[model samples]
Target: MKTLSFDGQRPCILQTASSVGKKEGEGNLTPFYDNIFQDAYLGEKSWEKAESKLLKTNLKTLLEKANESPENIDIVFGGDLLNQCISSNYGLLDFHIPFLGLYGACSTFVEGMILAAMAVHGNYAQKAIALTSSHFCSSERQFRFPLEYGGQRTPTSQWTVTGSGAALIAKGGEIEITHATIGRIIDYGISDINNMGAAMAPAAIETIRRHFQDRNLPNDYFDLVVTGDLGSVGKQITQQQLKNYGLDLEDRYIDCGDKIFDKEKQDAHAGGSGCGCCASVFSGWLYYLLRTGKCRRILLTATGALMSPTSSFQGESIPGIAHCISIERKTDNQ
Candidate 1:
C-alpha cells in the first residue's frame, strides 16, 4: 500500500519554460517568463484554441531551451481545467509522444511533476515533460457564465490565469526533485462556487502538516514554501491552521495565486486561480530564483478544488486535495 508520503531517488530538472498571456505578462514575474504572447488568442480562432496554443508554445520553448527534439522526450504528462483536458490532449497531438493526461484542477502542474519525477526515479524514462495550462475565458465558459454575460463576481472569486508552463525532466541536472507528499481528499462541505480558496484551505493545511511529519523535518527545512492557487483566503486559513500545529511557516510561504496579479488595480478580486497559477510562477519566477541561489530547498504544495461544473450543479460540496514536491538546487541535492 502507498503511504501518504513516499521517498525515492531525486530526478533532475533539466530545463523549464513559461509562456503566458498579456495580463500575466504584465505581472510581477514578467521578467522571468521566456515567452509572452501579446495576443491572448495567439492567432487562434477561439479561446480554447488559444489555450491549446499556449501549451504548444510552452512545449516548443522548453524543447528549444533544452536543445532537444520531440523524439527526445520519453513521455509527456500534462493537464488543464478543460472539461476533458482537451487543451493538453490536442496541443501536443503532433508530438506523438506517449502521453498521460491528468486532472487536479489548479494542482495539475505539481501532479504532473510528481509523476514525471517518479518515472525518472524508477528508471522508466530518461526524459519526460511535465506541463499544464489554463485560460481565463476557457475556464470561465466551462465553469461559470459566458464571457459576454458580464456577470457580477463575488469578492471571493478568483481570476483564472491564461498561460502555460513546461519543464523537461531528465538525468543529470542542476535542480533535483527530491520528495513528494500525495494528499488525500478533504471536504469541509463548502458549496459556493466563488469561494474555492476557502474550500481548498483545509486540504492544503493537512498536506503541509503531513509532509512535515513524514519527512521529520521542521518548518525551516525548506528555504521557501509555496501553495498553488490558494490566493489570500486559503493562505490565511492555512497559516492559522499551521500555527495551531506549531508549524510556523512565517516568511517562507508564497501563495502563487496571491502573487499573480494586482488585486486592487487589476480587478482580480482574489488574485489568480487556475492550473497555470503555480505552473507559470514555478517554471518562470520561482525556478529562476532557485537557479540564482536565492533559495536552497523549497517545498511546493499545489492545492486543487476537485469540484466540477456537474458536481457543483448537483449540490455536491467541493472536495480538495494538495500534492507537495521538494525541489532543491544542485548543492542542496548533494
Candidate 2:
C-alpha cells in the first residue's frame, strides 16, 4: 500500500468477481458475435456498455450474497484500462457508493486488494469495495491495434483477456489478515516482449524472498503460494531459481496463468498476462477454495509487464513488477 497521504480505511473483498469462468466479470458479452475474434473481444466496445456489464455482474453478485444493497457500501474502489478508467464510469451508473479509480496495469487486482486491505487494516474504515476488469478488445485497440487485424505480435506479447474480476474486503468481518508482507515492485527492463518469462521471474523471486524476510514466514507456513500469471516458462524459472536462494516455493506455489487455459489447445504462448488473466483465475479458482474450505492461507502475488507497445517499439526493454499479498479465509465468517 503506497500511502503518500492518509488512507481512510483498508478494504476487504466482499465479493469474488463473478465466481464463474468464461464469466468472471463478463455478463451477457459472452455469446457469439460477427467475428470469432470479435466474439473474443477483438475490438473496443462502447464504454457505456462495458462499464455497465462490469457493474451489473460483479455488483449483482455482491448484492445477492452479502445481504446488502449497493447503497450500504461505504465506497467503491476500482479502475480500468481507459485514460480516466472509462469502464468505471458505466460501473458507477447504478451503484450509489463513492468511487475511486486505480491503475497498476496488470497488477491492478493486487493493487486494489493492497489498498483496500491497508485502508481497513489501518483502521480507516469498516468496509470498502475494490475491483478491476479488462477487455481484450478495448486494451488492444487502445494500447496496440485492433486484434482483428493481422498485426505481427512479438514472441513476448501476452494476449489480454476479455474479462472482469472484483473482490470485496471487510475488516472485523468474516476473513482476517493475520499478517501481510508487502513487496516492492522490482523491474528488469528487458526489451524482448516475446520472452516475458525471463523478465518477470527475477522480480517474483526477489519479492517472495523479501516477503519471507519481512514476516519471518517459513516457506511451508502457507498452504499454497500463487503467482499472478507468469505462464509456464516464468513459473519454471521461478521454481528452479528459488532453490538457489534456499527458498523452496515448490509445487505448492503455483502459477495462475498456466491453469487458466489449456496451453496446448489454446496455443497461448507462455500463457496470458494482462489483468483478466489473474482476475478470471482468482475469481474462478481461488474463490472456490475460499468457499469450500479447501485451503485457507493463500499467498497470491500478481505480476505486470510494465511495458507498452510504444516502449517496445522505441527500443526500450520490458520492465516487470510484482505485488505480493496474503489472503486467508475467515473461519469466523461462517
Candidate 3:
C-alpha cells in the first residue's frame, strides 16, 4: 500500500483539453469537451492512426489553450491501449519534447499525470504534459471483436470510448496536484472480458480505502471522488465494498464511465470503458468543476484491468490496478 503525500509546492494543472468522438460529444458532458469530431476517422486512414491523431490534436489544443508551444514543454508523459503504446509513440513523433510512453490500460491518463507531476515538482522539469487516448474501432479490434464481425455483445459489455485528453502541468498554478496512491494488483479470478466492471471493482475499492487510510482523511474530505470506467455495475460493487468497510461514499462519488453516456438510450450496456473514458471526462468536466470552484478537492482514482487477449485465452484471471491522485483548488489557507 504505497501512498505518496506530496509536500511543499505541488505541481499545478495549467491547462487541459479533451477531444472526443461523436457519441461522447453527444453525452452528458458535451459542453465541457474542447473539440468533437463527427467522423470517428478524423480524416485518418485507419482506426489506430485516428487514435494517434486524437492524441496529437489533444496535446496541440492543450498547448494552444495555455498559449505555449511544444518547445515550452520540458517533457511529455503519455500512453494508450495499443501494443507498445504505438499510438502515443507515433502521435507525438513530430514534437521535439522528450517523451516517456506508459501503459496502464484504462488508467494510463492518471499514470502519466502522476509521473509528469513528479518530474515537475521534483524540479527535474519546469513543465510537462500528461496525455492518453483511445478509439472505439482500434480498441475493439485489439481487445475484442472486429468491427466487421458485428459480434453480439454481452449485456455486461462496455463500449470503448473514442477520445483523447492532454493536460499541462507547470511549477505554479491555481490547481494543485496534492497526493497520490499507487495501487496493488488484485485478481479475484474474473475471466469474462465483457464484465470488466466486475473484474475491476475490487481494485478500485481497495485503492480508495488505502488512500483514505494513508491520508488519514474521511470520505467527505474531498468534495468529489471520481472513479474511472467502473460504469454502473462496478460502481455498485465499489459502493457496496465501501459500505462493507464502514465507509459510505454515496454523496460525492461519480464514475467517469457512468457519466459518458445515457444508459437508457445509448445501449452502452455497462457504459463506457477505455483509456479515453476517464481521460476525456476528467480533462473536460472535472477540470472545469475544479477550476470554477464547483469542486474544492477531488480524489480521482482511475482503475485499470491488467489483462490481455493472450492472458484471457490462457485462462488467466484479470488482475486489476487503480492509481489515485488528489487535485485541489490552490488557496492561501495554509
* Regions more than 4 Å wrong, model 1: 1-9
Report clashes for each candidate as comma-separated counts: 0, 22, 0
Tens digit per residue, CA lDDT, model 2, 1-334: 3212212332345566442234222322222111112233222266335544644566566666677777766666677666567777776767777777877677777777777776766766466776776665567677777657986775455666555566677755444444454555566666676677677887778777777776676778777888877877889888888878888877787887666655555645666666766766676567667566787777777777777777878988777777777666666323
| Deviation in Å, model 3, residue 184 alpha carbon | 0.8
Tens digits of per-residue lDDT for model 3 on 1-334? 4688668988989999999999998888889999999999999999989999998989889989999988878999999999999899889999878998898999889998899888988999999999999999999899887788957888888998998988899877999999888888888989999999899999899999998988788768889899999889999899888988977887799899998998888878899999999999999999999999999899999989899999999989989989999999988225
* Ranking of all candidate structures by their lDDT, best first: 3, 1, 2
Give the winner by TM-score. 3
Candidate 1: residue 151 lDDT (0-100): 82
RMSD per model, one decimal: 1.5, 5.2, 1.0
- List candidate 2 stretches off by more than 4 Å: 1-14, 19-52, 151-156, 330-334
TM-score of 3: 0.98
lDDT of 1 by residue, 2-33 (tens): 22332355687888999888898888778999
Which candidate ranks first by lDDT, i.e. highest? 3
Comparing 1 with 2 on TM-score, the higher-scoring candidate is 1
Better of 2 and 3 by lDDT: 3
RMSD of 1: 1.5
Ranking by TM-score: 3, 1, 2
